[model samples]
Target chain A: MLAVQTIADGLVLGGLYALAAVGFSLIFGVLGVVNLSHGAIVMMGAYLTWFVWHTTGLDPLLAIPPVMLVLFAFGYVYQRGLIQLAVDRSSLLASMLVTFGVALMLRNLLVLVFSPDFKSITPGYAFNYLRLGEVTIDLVRISALAASLALLGALAWVLNRTRIGRVIRATAQQELAARLCGVNARHVYGMTFGVSAAFAGASGAILGIVLPFAPPDEANWTLNAFVVVVLGGVGSPSGALLGGLVLGLISTATSQLIGPAFPNAMMFLILVLMLMVRPAGLLGNAFAASR
Target chain B: MLAEALARHRWWIALTLLGIAAAAVVPFVLMPFHVRVGQMILLSTGLGLAWTLLGGFAGYWSFGHTAFIGLGAFAAGLFEVNALGTEFMRTDPLLGFALGLLAGMAACAVAAALVAWPILRLRGIYFAVAMLGVAQVLSELTNSIEAFQGSLGLVLPRIPAFGLRTEAVFYYLLLIAAVIILAIAFLVKNARIGQGLAAMREDEDTARMLGVPTERYKITMFVLSAALTGALGVIYAHSLGYITTGSVYRTDFSLNMIVYNLLGGIGTLVGPLIGAAIMVLLTQVVLGSFLNLHMFLTGAMLVALVVAAPKGIMGGLAGTWQSWRRRRTAAP
Candidate 1:
């Protein structure tokens, strides 16, 4: 029963991780550029949700679509104007730096506008929980988990079946080849980045439920997302799901067993060990082959 | 010809010497607060160069170098606490300095080895994130540990005579270290290993195929970079007369170092130094007045520079010069 409870908790957290990691992995897969600004986008989404909830008394979950739309447009414009310039450059390091600069600007902008206050959207049912035999589960966590899995499934289906998805995957594999094959590679890349931003926006809405939202604290989320993506395998969505679960479980389990301080260390240690043993990651080779 | 060349370079060297000489005499000219700021610039320059070894030369961008800097600072602080044998003891400052530097380097090397194992395998942004994780974990561990003073941080034994005690001496010491590091950067830029690093930067697989031993070079450069940064940490701790997790493990320092390197020009020997000087001066002039607006302006500047002049200030100047020369040559 205790083990079941832990698993339940892990799965809930894992769901959030999955949402974060998948968006990160998708950006990497489609563009071959790590969107370092993804976490900041998530933070922005969270802030937007919080603002709507506070002002209009709307449920945070209900605020997702509007937030997603805003971020999607931002991502589209950013990529077209900025990221495309670096696509041909040998080092994506510059892109990462640029995004980091953007992130710093965004974070400071938020701080200036909102101040460094922690905010959360606590719906009327925020504290509600369901009893399952001997274990209890939070309704919010369960919903977040379900939504995450459903989103992941939808994304997987889209990538496998949809024309746009095909174009994105093709571009990921070979940009020039995709271009030669009559695919508007630039449009696909921009759309893919927008979709990635939407995923992050959705994740942000969910994260506001799980944790309090702090504007400058997006750096933590960004770092954690990076670890999850790397651990899962860079460009694999399913791998991201598994990686997030594994990380969430490891972090949760380690925190429970040893103490809170050791979980981060253990997670980093695991990452180091994994990289030493498998540079391509457990699920990365297949995607690497595709690329 | 050698004499002529030496004579020509002499003016440049003299100007540098004169600058340092003026800096050394700054304690008498400026307020103590300004002197402290000067000390910070000298210390940060060492750190900026330390970051350049990997980020600029090897093209491995580490976003968590604060772990090394912090570790170095704490190790030095610990040594100071024990060696002085008094809460306020300032005796045998030289011994404290030696121990602090050695411990800083040793700790950084070990931390680098630990961090490098997982992070080095990942490329680009993944590597940067992994480093941040390492730094956060270390900071948490440091915060939880009791002997390291936990979250409250460790206080160094204050030396007698505030002005004459250590800050000025540490300033000169840091300045000397910076010059040595600059010389080392020049040597590394021209050496076989430097060539290997450049090749790897150009194309990793091709460099490996050409027998560059990419991993060895990466780790070596990472360790060397950490060592220099650690030394800076020791100097920083001694100059400040206190050590805390907040001061030591600052992410802003890491960010500033990266900004400095990029703002000056990447993959250039003098770039980090130039970047550090410009940034430090900017901060001193601008941030000192408008603290809140500083970050906003810096971020905007970084974005603008990346878009407008990706090669940075130095690179932009060189590009303009080359274009002018090409046009002049074509006039014939």
Candidate 2:
């Protein structure tokens, strides 16, 4: 029963990781810059949803659209006003510093305004669980997982089947080629950031459904996202899903069997080991050249 | 040309060193509280200078430098904390400080050497990520390990009647460290090794093709960087009179180190010093007024620096002055 529960929990956690990592990997792929601030963006999503839900007494899930929309605009303007300048200067150090600085500012601002207290949203269904013969699962977990899978599907459809998707792919693969093809690479970059942040914000709201969050908790999510990106491969959408599940299972199993604190170290260890053993990550072929 | 340049600046170099030595008195002359604050500023300069080798010079970008720092702090803690499983240095006082510092240096250097081989094979972002992971592992390991007292942390025993009040002594020691680090950076920057590292930073394949021995030089600079920073970590740990795993390996230190280097100007000798002073002043004088807005302001400052002045204050100002001189001459 415990084993079944852990596996079930792992699956739900994996869903969260996949949802977050997709956007993170997307930003990395298109911009060629790791959005170090992605975690803060994720945190922002959760807080925004909670704020809307708390004040208006609205259904928490209803807040997703507005949360996503706000984050999307923020990410877009953030890329154009700040990140584009770094890109223009053609400095990796500048981009990294700027993203990190923004992330730091966001983290601190959240703490300053929110008072470092952990905030949780209690929808009516937060504790209601669906029992499966001898095992039970929270409805929130199942809904969050379904939402993530849906987001992943929508992301896939956009990337694989749409015009903007093609532009994004072209810009990511070869910015100059995309430019020569009459695509505005800069605009595509901004669009990519917007799309990715929307996905990230939605996933973060889903995550907020399950886990109460504090300011520093965002860094934890960011680190896990990095693990997912590395485990899955930098640019592979499917790879992120697979990697997320792999990590979720591993961490769930480890934490269940060992101490709770051990999984963080273990996850990071696996990440480093993966980088050494396979620089291209698990699904090596898709974006092997990224490193 | 090189000889002429040195001849022109020989007095300037001597005067600077002399000035640092002379300024050591300001700490003792001022109130004890002021000395303590000065000590922190000096410590930042020392750590920033040491960081320049890998971060600025070699361009390795070890983001998890907190690993070395934590390890170095623990190395000192082991001697001073006097737990059930410790030996040596316990019987002796002065010998402990000397041996403890050496141990700190060696531990970080060896740790860096251990990971450098596998990590250095990768490039840029990958290496940075790996370092971050390494730090996480080390911090966790420290917290979980019984020898580290399971994160409750250890308090160092104060030396009985040590020369110069402990605070003043540590302050002077920090000043010396800052001076030593600056001297080492200057020497390395002017040497053949520095040029090799510079070449490797610019283009490793080209440097390798040019017979620059890229791997050896990178590891050397990295080890040296770790050793110096590790040394500071030791002093920092014991100076606190109590050290904890979380405090020593805090991510803020690593972030601040990176920001200080970038804020001044990467790859320049005086940049870290200039950056550290400005950062300390901002934190101490300006942001000090805010209840908890320091981090926010620091982050804002970092973003502004990167956006408006990516080359940093020193590099950006120099470029502007040079361009202005060119424009004036052309107009004439």
Deviation (Å) of B71 in candidate 1: 1.5
- For residue A139, give model 1's deviation from the true position in Å: 1.6
Candidate 1 structure quality by residue, lDDT tens digits, B1-332: 44554476677667767777877788778776777677767776777788888888887889888888888888777766775466334556556567668977898898887667557867666678677777787777888877787488787754334456355666677888887777677567667888899998887889999999999999989998988888887777766766678778876777778887778888775677677777777877657787876666666766666666678778878999999999999996
Off by over 4 Å in 2: A286-291, B1-9, B83-92, B144-146, B159-163, B320-332
At residue A49, candidate 2 shows an lDDT of 85
Could you tell me which residue pairs clash in candidate 1?
A272-B118
Q: For this target, which candidate reaches the highest lDDT against the unseen true structure?
A: 2
Task: Encode model 1's per-residue lDDT on A1-291: one tens digit a residue.
Answer: 877888888888887888877877888877877777788888888888888888999988888889889988988888888887754442476777777777777888888877888987788888999999988998888888887888788888888899888888899889899999999988888898888888888889888887888876677677667668767886667888988898888878887878877877887788767666665667755334221
* Cα lDDT computed for each candidate against the true fold: 0.78, 0.82
Which pairs clash (backbone N, Cα, C closer than 3 Å) in model 2?
A: none
* Cα lDDT for residue B5, candidate 1: 41
- Residue-level error in angstroms, candidate 2, position B4: 10
Rate residue A268 of model 1 by lDDT.
76
